[model samples]
Target: MTSDTREPAAPTLQPRNTPARVSFWSAASGIGLIVAVVVTPMFWLPYGSHYTFALLMLGAVAVPAGHLGRRRGKRPDARDRGLALFGIVTGWLLILVSLLVFVVFTGTLAALGLLFGTLD
Candidate 1:
């Protein structure tokens, strides 16, 4: 009679040159996203509403920022990960709400219906 249980294999870490390591490109992307979201609307061309700029820019920012958040540092700490992710996600949520408000104010949703459909 023999025991069937086996020990789990330990996770092997890769060498320093691992391709997945944090990179300048990823960090630059993260910084760009955050900066554009926070800064661009102020300098944006005159528009009908703040929501227009927010709608256009914030969602664009959140996706890649959140992606790069994980690999922001070669050895990112919990705070780095948390701040990056929270900033991205929160910014996105705000943008979505702002877009809804924009659709209501600008009648954009109604306009789309008329583009290819006959309006009585």
Candidate 2:
């Protein structure tokens, strides 16, 4: 009996040339959900809320910055990947921060609603 000792073929890794598709609606809904969670605190604040401007600034700075700074992975004249990575990280950070802020905001509102009679 002849014994075959051939090594198994290695799997090929397909090159990822296509950039991730970011839709306007998905982004918008994400922003909106986060905002709904966070913005409720403004209504309960004694004075005009300081958090309003913070949310606005987040949107103003993060959304466009994120969109404008996505990675162009396949371009011949692509800029440093570090910058793109930074942008992606920063974008995610902003999204997470928004989510956290919204959570606190909504919780505070729910507490207030329970205290009052508006929760129904």
Each candidate structure's TM-score, on Cα atoms with residue i matched to residue i, is 0.40, 0.40
lDDT of 1 by residue, 1-120 (tens): 898998999986533421212222333444564466467765433543653554546555654665565454346232245545555565565567567757776686577787757755
Model 1 scores worst on lDDT over the 10 consecutive residues at 17-26
Q: Each model's number of backbone clashes?
A: 0, 2
Candidate number with greatest lDDT: 1
lDDT of 2 by residue, 17-63 (tens): 22222223233444664566557755535532344344445544544
What Cα-based lDDT does every candidate model obtain? 0.52, 0.50
**How many residue pairs in model 2 have overlapping backbones?**
2
Q: List the residue pairs that clash in candidate 2.
A: 37-102, 38-102
